[model samples]
Target: MPRERVIFLVDVQSFFASIEKTADRSLQHKPIVVAGDPERRSGVILAACPLAKQWGIETAEALWEAQQKCPGVTVVKPHMQKYIEISVQLTAIMESFSDLVEPYSIDEQFIDLTPTLHLFGGSPYQAARLLQHKIQQEIGVYARIGIGPNKVLAKMACDNFAKKNKEGIAHISYDTLPATLWPLPVRSLFGVGSRMSRHLERMGIRTIGQLAQTPVERLRKKWGINGERLWLTANGIDESPVSPRSHDEQKAIGHHMTLPRDYETLEQIKVILLELSEEVGRRARRKGYVGDTVSVGVRGARFDLPTGFHRQTKLTEKTNDGLDVFKAAFDLFCTHWDGEPIRSAGVALSGLEPDHCRQLSLFNFETTLKKERLSKAVDHIKNKYGAAAILRAASLTAAGQARDRAQKIGGHYK
Candidate 1:
């Protein structure tokens, strides 16, 4: 039997800038480009308010380009601490409606409203509308919400309803999906990215209806398991649930980054590693967790196409300390250097458990004490002031850009 489920996909509008304007009334209705300084040519454009978008500025655009397009744009560096504080509060608010709120990302979440609609004393439509009003009124950020029988459908509905106005809510069911959804382009479905869209276009499948009608075996032959999944999505047949648990369960924690420039020198690479270590360590401490494994990834410079080293490593013990993670990460980098010019690198920590889960190693015991105290101090400063209150030297450049761009500094190092 199909269990009744109503997933609420809530997406904050112009998240970073919106939050900033929400906090300070003075910035409202002003052209706001949250990003780094145009001088350094550093930092990606993170978010833009409606006014900035009108000037052709957008997230991930170069700050210089944004300035050229919109001379009056105001760049504001990110406030990671503020975003987190607001996220915590918003999550609490969402939880009040149901215990099954799953944060899909920093700016969005999925909620299971199946069981609680009756208690709210109305139809799901009424409940959803009320929820939207509550979030906008309480959080000071307008959000687009979609309701459907499953998570994926709800997500699509949210995207469909996210047009110019707060026509802000959409509900989709299998019975009405053909008219409401199938008319949209194939790209409207979740799994179809640029590459997939090109492939589908080649096959004369330009619409969701065409993709849905394609034979499953034909899809599997071309795109493997993902093709079959795509076919299902085209038919409005998403069975995924609005899980309270995150997808992070099987893995503890991991981080990856793309470099703006390639590096050949060991010193330059070491600086990058130190920055990554600081991130892994901070997240571990924030969650009261530690990991027994530390792994690093490298991508070689690609003149023709992007490429490089990708590898992992096991550690001697679990640790939440940046120094230890950095040491292990550096050791792996040296092992894999192969005299190649590195383009990008990343670090990850797995085998996580609560800090008190295991005993410290004899070699690590003494050093762990010092690391703990230092980490706590850093965390306190970051928690109170902002993520920039403490950072490794390598991060200063990016942090400065973040300040200019108006991103939440210290975003989960995804």
Candidate 2:
């Protein structure tokens, strides 16, 4: 018989806000939130501490709404670089407990402790407690841990039970699913959100147990492989491994920006599109990859109605040149745009291959070689000085966002 797998999904409580509290002891007990600059049109709550949560402040809510809820809420601008550094440090700490550690996100990670459980305390709970304590002691932040036989149950355990339980540790298994997880609403399942829960409820599967009891064939016929996967997850069956290199595999490189105001003209929209294309190209080059597919996405300024288009086109040859990407992206935009006042635009490159594998252009061989060398030189200068060190003439235009974006990470101040 095979040994039951012991997996843990560890989540840092109010990661960004907690880090802010830890860095400033004066705000340790005060209601606080990490938010973007109000002047930049990114004035939304990114993370809120427990005290803030008590005031009904939530992530993704407008900062003004949070302020209305709690007049004295201490708002701290996000330090993305600091958060990333601490996340890396946290990952290093988890690696000490087990070799099979995978980062699910900046604030969540999965660790398979099947083999190391005995080394820690000979029991799953004992090991989890120790790990939790170590994180608090070293990082000055609280962690909620969910233990299970697989990743899905572990994630659900953390989100549904551990975070709410007093001890901040919860365990779930196939044996416990009927008694513990099945009684909850179907929406509480890891993969089931509001939209999916509605679909399941319409099928008379209002609880996880109901979903688990429904025929897999019925779900498979409806949602194809996804429905079957949901059913398996409801049954607490997940065979995925915790691999450390999960994020190293890149499928695409993309960048998106929400404009300060609506851009109504094609020229203005194209300016932002070109800036996005440059960023996409720079990132791809930094990673030593080239791509053949360019995608353009645009969203309208109207919030009351749905509006936007995401389209992609394949080039004859893969290239990481900014101008090349912009040409393709611009063509796509011109072909599909509906002439709405745009609020945001994005550019992406996919169908990736290593730069070394790129075939020389048959017609523009010399020009291509020169462009590649020039791009490398520019990349080198930017890396040594800063991202804003070298810029295209278009980036100096009022419509360009590259300058402002260079000062940010993930659309927030670094």
* Number of the predicted model whose lDDT against the real structure is largest: 2
Local accuracy of candidate 2 as per-residue lDDT tens digits, 1-414:
588899999999999999999999999889999989888878999999999999999899999999999999999999999999999989999999998999999999999999888899889899999999999999999999999999999999999999999999999988888999999999998888799999988988999999999999999999999999999999999899999888767899999988988999998888998889988999999888999999999999999977899999999999999989999999999999888899988999999988899888789999999998998899999889888998888788888888888888887788
Query: lDDT value for candidate 1?
Result: 0.78
TM-score of 1: 0.78
Q: Where does candidate 1 have its weakest 10-residue lDDT segment?
A: 399-408
Clashes of each: 17, 0
- Cα lDDT tens digits for candidate 1, 1-414: 675577788888888899989877988878987775444455678889988998888789887788899888877877667777777777788888888899888888888978887776657677777877888888899888888888888889888765434568888887788888888888888878998898899999998888888998999998789889999889888766677766446465666655556777887788778777777888888877899788898888867765567667788788888888999999988887876667667888888887877797788678788879988998898779876666666656442222221233433221
> How far in Å is the alpha carbon of 63 misplaced in model 2?
2.5
Root-mean-square deviation of Cα positions for candidate 2 versus the true structure, in angstroms: 3.1
Which residues of candidate 1, in runs, are more than 4 Å off? 1-3, 162-166, 247-279, 297-311, 333-346, 354-414
Per-model TM values vs. the true structure: 0.78, 0.87
Give per-model CA RMSD: 5.0, 3.1
- Poorest 10 consecutive residues by lDDT, candidate 2: 393-402
